[model samples]
Target: MSTVVNQTTPHRSGSVAVIGRPNVGKSTLTNALVGAKISIVSNRPQTTRHRLLGIATFAAGKDAPAGQIALVDTPGLHRQQGKFSASAMSKVMNRAARGALEGVDAAMLVIEAGRWDDEDTLAYNVLSDAGIPVLLIVNKIDRLRDKSALLPFLAQVSQGRTFAGVHPVSALKRNGLDALVKELLMLLPEAPPMFGEDEITDRSERFLAGELVREQLMRQLGAELPYATTVEIERFAEDTSLKQGELLRIGAVIWVERESQKAIVIGKGGARLKEIGSKSRLQMERLFGRKVFLETWVRVREGWSDDETALKAFGYE
Candidate 1:
């Protein structure tokens, strides 16, 4: 009698760096794939200042095998020249983007539909030098006025370049993502899941709490003012007094470079600061799945963004 040989399918798991220029919706795509708001999103450029991991695990499907994708969501690659971009903080952000690409099995080069410039080329060059498989993600196609123009745009970008796969997607509307996920998973190596299926991110709650507050700053503040500020979580602790669930008490300090900037963030009668805190608390509760009691203070840090030491203290690395 012939014995039947048992065969098992392999699981694909590896890291993929999300590479793009500023304001290209890299973080939005990262969160969409992870099924959680691990990275914050805003219209302002360089909103993502640090490297963060977003883990996405998928079940086996008709077209794709089971896999886990550890997304290294990076700071948008940008040139350092403008007053905002020339600061020490900007240099740190660029370094963080390059560093996050180390040891990744693949990369997703995200770009806005119908737009490509020097910064985008800079990002593509960095990824190409890594010698890893790249998937070109043409994001925000839904935002384009002429959807028919998408194909030509994709063709223009892919002309002299090599991509493992090309996908047009709307990260905000969740369009064309199922196929994108399958394409990305195939680029990874066959291995067991590196992270648990339930894990959406590798960042700690304290780190995420601070980031949520910073996200509010980027959204609510004036263009130049937001660049001058950063959020520091002074305290994060759980209060288990409630019967329904534990309450998270978080304290955040919005650090500004000047006293005038502090006044701007606080607004008249502290209304602006209150709005920031309220919105931030709501986002924290949504992400943490628990009640959050948050307190915010605007403090002057005297050019903290340009200070390397201050950047390290506030977790720039």
Candidate 2:
């Protein structure tokens, strides 16, 4: 038997770094484009701490071109200094964001609808200086009650900078994504696909599991405690000893900077910790497609966010 492959027209393939300020829906847009939750989403700012690659493959059709875009979801670019910022972590995150844009073929600067502040300007300057085609992505338009305001907002943002293209999209609602993807495909260079068509992301299941746990922490704790929390997966392995269906065993540690923060995360009578564990386990099961035995522990690491050694141990380079 011989394997046959269909020969299509020249395929355009390259990477695009998704850059933006904190809480600008960059992760949501990356997940939307890839059709899966590669990057975790949360309402809190600075939710993304690492660079994640989400692969979006556009199939050849009568009205669409064939292409594969490796979308690099980066940490929010911000001018971090002064008394309020975690200086060490801020430097690490900014370094990661800049590194993600170093070799990408193009870039996308995501901004919230009807809002562009100093941080947005900072992000725009960084993306512009990368010397790559930067696409202006105006996200969260679904929040706007008046649709007429979108055009003027886009027009306002387009001034004083030359963007490769401008697109208005609601990532949560999956609106205007097709057009955005099409425009992105046009910007990618002609080359072979870097990843398999079936692959959606370059991150491992363990990394994604940790991110999901952190996401639950951010969502459950609301605006009060998430900034001080970070999840680290200590162990992830399959229990092959089981005779029945596969069971994944995951052990994670929720690191807090102080004992008081740990107590807050654990909550009264351990109810909050239990809730976070339950939600994280459910999400992990869905992502892994198997039974999961999740064990989570809360540990206090004093000033871990500001300590260089602790940051390195927590996988921040």
The lDDT of each candidate is 0.90, 0.87
Q: Per-residue lDDT for 231-251 in model 1, tens only?
A: 899989888677555798899
The worst-scoring run of ten residues by lDDT in candidate 2 lies at: 1-10
Q: Estimate each model's TM-score.
A: 0.95, 0.95
Q: Please give the distance, in angstroms, between residue 44's alpha carbon in candidate 1 and its true position after superposition.
A: 0.9
Candidate 2 has a TM-score of 0.95
Error in Å for residue 53 of model 1: 0.1
Q: Kindly report which residue stretches of model 1 are placed more than 4 angstroms away from their true locations once superposed.
A: 1-8, 222-224, 240-245
Candidate 2 per-residue lDDT, tens place, 149-226, comes to 888888888888889989889999998888888778888888889999999998899989999999998898748775
Scanning candidate 1 in windows of ten residues, the lowest lDDT window is: 1-10
What ranges in model 2 sit over 4 Å off? 1-8, 82-86, 243-245
RMSD of 1: 4.2
